[model samples]
Target chain A: MQISASKWLDIWQANRRLTRRVIEAFPEDQLFSFSIGGMRTFGDMIKELLAVEGPGIEEIVTGVRQKFDEHASYQTKHELLDKWDAETARIDKFWADLPSEKYLERVNLFGQYESSVIDAILYFVENEIHHRGQGFVYLRSLGIQPPFFWER
Target chain B: MQISASKWLDIWQANRRLTRRVIEAFPEDQLFSFSIGGMRTFGDMIKELLAVEGPGIEEIVTGVRQKFDEHASYQTKHELLDKWDAETARIDKFWADLPSEKYLERVNLFGQYESSVIDAILYFVENEIHHRGQGFVYLRSLGIQPPFFWER
Candidate 1:
């Protein structure tokens, strides 16, 4: 949907900002509340999103799965937010350095069917949007107000 | 990009099946295991994916932020798999029901931005591929073997 390379970056940045705002809106105690029946807590969703930009993208670009710190802990909402901000910054640079033609080239995604780089990038944005919508529902179910959806 | 609507459906169906296989490959204990440090266990990621579909589609159909999850309980892995199967079926039916001109019309995705219906469909497939890639990484980290990348 985003035609230009710069447009992708813009969309990514907006998505990251929106996600961060939603994470910030939740109280610390509610972050890990997995008691919403079978739903993951808001904290859980944010962690998944944060990791996707760093470990997820790292694997995509390097063609190798990086061994992550299996015990890395985030004690506070700030820790998650910090990681979210840092990874977005890293992704912005990654996008800046990426050539537009690279988007059309197919890459081995986890040894699965080869997918074009453009489709992969779109996947990244769409995945975040999907999760962010979940975070909104979690927030409302917890009686917390989510950030304005259009801030992005 | 897949120019034909049927071509996009074919790809989307393939991507959904791959996700289903990856979800089936993991054990029950790790579904919610965020214990792997920076990684989101397969369970959490799958829930996020399932939770987003209704709202995401609602966004595409409506121009405003629809109420978030007025009626969704957190679904189990089996429940999620059932959803994945149902969505794939629903998508095929929805695609068949559409007129040719709807593919070219720009639709509002929850007021986030405007995207053509075709681009929106492409976005769905790409999102599944990205998360399935993460599932593979999680599987490998846990010393489990993922489904063959090209078995489909």
Candidate 2:
């Protein structure tokens, strides 16, 4: 009944793909300035995702926990997309390298999240979808149609 | 390192609890009428979750597919909270009845989604988080602060 690593990767990839589409739907001017309540802008939320997932997955692979940091600079939407593309590759590379059983092994992720790799990854994917949902709301408020959820 | 059904239930319960909090944070007037672009209101979104999860779990337990239908009448925020509580119990009842191996079995969920029970459940959890994220944005737009997401 255990889900294989490949299946987990597929789930992660689908969620990330959808999130990327959500990011692309954001208007350039609104991406960083739009805020709901006191929540960080969509741009800031995306940075948090970039900061967390890539390093979290990499640490899961290397068994070396690094301090949580927003590693890459994100200035323009294009830059964000570029870095997002790079991080996409990073996920495929490191996730492919992981031994299947390692997914079931628990790790203290980034000294913050402590769970098995699979659960940790689920948390990662769900977190992105959660934020992207915010972006969807933002786009709708701005009169833009956010991408469909199932398109990913 | 395989996750037990109990663990998955724990994850589901935590998510549902947080979602219930998100529901509580909504202003009465905004729950049903607020829409960004053309998306459903928060009330509609929560009803979808209520419709899906309780019955989805029941379907898995009985191996009988049922059409997706919104079961509860949610007129007021209090009614919504009441239904949420009932659905929480419904999940526990059906989920507890399921055999552990059923977690790996595939069901044609609502005659739509075709995936293993675990994936279906994960989809259920993620979908709620996604919509709740939308509600968070709505609250923010109304200058209302959403309940902290991590409180779960």
Candidate 3:
């Protein structure tokens, strides 16, 4: 493998840290309501991300699948952040149970989206980066300097 | 390696195709002037992608570095798309010169960022995905649906 499973975890964690900062940068009011070009607000985007990672890893580890849902709402930024932090811990715990060899195994994510486990995980990361990019623009439009993209 | 170098190239090309569709979706006038929340026009974002990939790969292949520049202007969307197609070819050509082993080598990209050649390449893809996400919002704001992210 070009990268060990643990190395990939580290990379994903770095990206998660940067994403946490993006969440922090948002003003509470704007986090859920401020969106440009008709895109979902940053808060909603976070919900989609939150819906995927921990549960996805848990499914991978347990050989179980759940319906994908991104509509679960948080009433405030603080609640959302708390959920995000909890998901992070959940992912770490499930990740420990995932054998590295399982990364090469194919699985149907969320009872749909069949792909190798690694690809599914990559999708989780890629999807986050994609939304976070929008978050970056959202911050910029608000005249805020988003944390550097490379800092991850 | 978890993925072969050729596989990475194929992945990048798929992304390039989607980004091309994004460029096509833009109205010529809006492509250059449209902004939401104070973000740069989509045209300017394309310039940065153009500046990075071909030259960055060339540097990796030739061991010669040049100053990064994203200021080169295009008169129309057609011209920018042409540049995009040309860079696609350039990346393919340079990619051929890069040995699989070289992916693990570290090089300073544009005399600034430093990382393994693979990470640098991953950044190129990740960066494109990032910007493309912003483009999705731009298109949605304009009421045009961007290409499906998963199609890549």
User: What is each candidate's DockQ, to 2 decimals?
Assistant: 0.06, 0.60, 0.59
- What level of docking quality does candidate 2 show? medium
> How many residue pairs clash (N, CA or C atoms closer than 3 angstroms) in each of the candidate models, in the order given?
1, 1, 4
lDDT of 1 by residue, A14-48 (tens): 87888789888878887776333354566776676
Q: Against the true structure, whose TM-score is highest? A: 3
Q: Rank the candidate models, highest DockQ first.
A: 2, 3, 1
Where's the lowest-lDDT run of ten residues in candidate 1 chain A? A33-42
Worst 10 residues of 1 chain B by lDDT: B66-75
Q: What RMSD value applies to candidate 1?
A: 9.4
lDDT by residue (tens digit), candidate 3, B20-60: 99999999999999987677899999999999998999999
Return the TM-score for each candidate structure: 0.52, 0.90, 0.94
List where candidate 3 sits over 4 angstroms from the true fold.
none
Worst 10 residues of 3 chain B by lDDT: B1-10
**Which scores higher on DockQ, 1 or 2?**
2
lDDT of 2 at A72: 51
- Candidate with better DockQ, 2 vs 3: 2
Which number leads on DockQ?
2
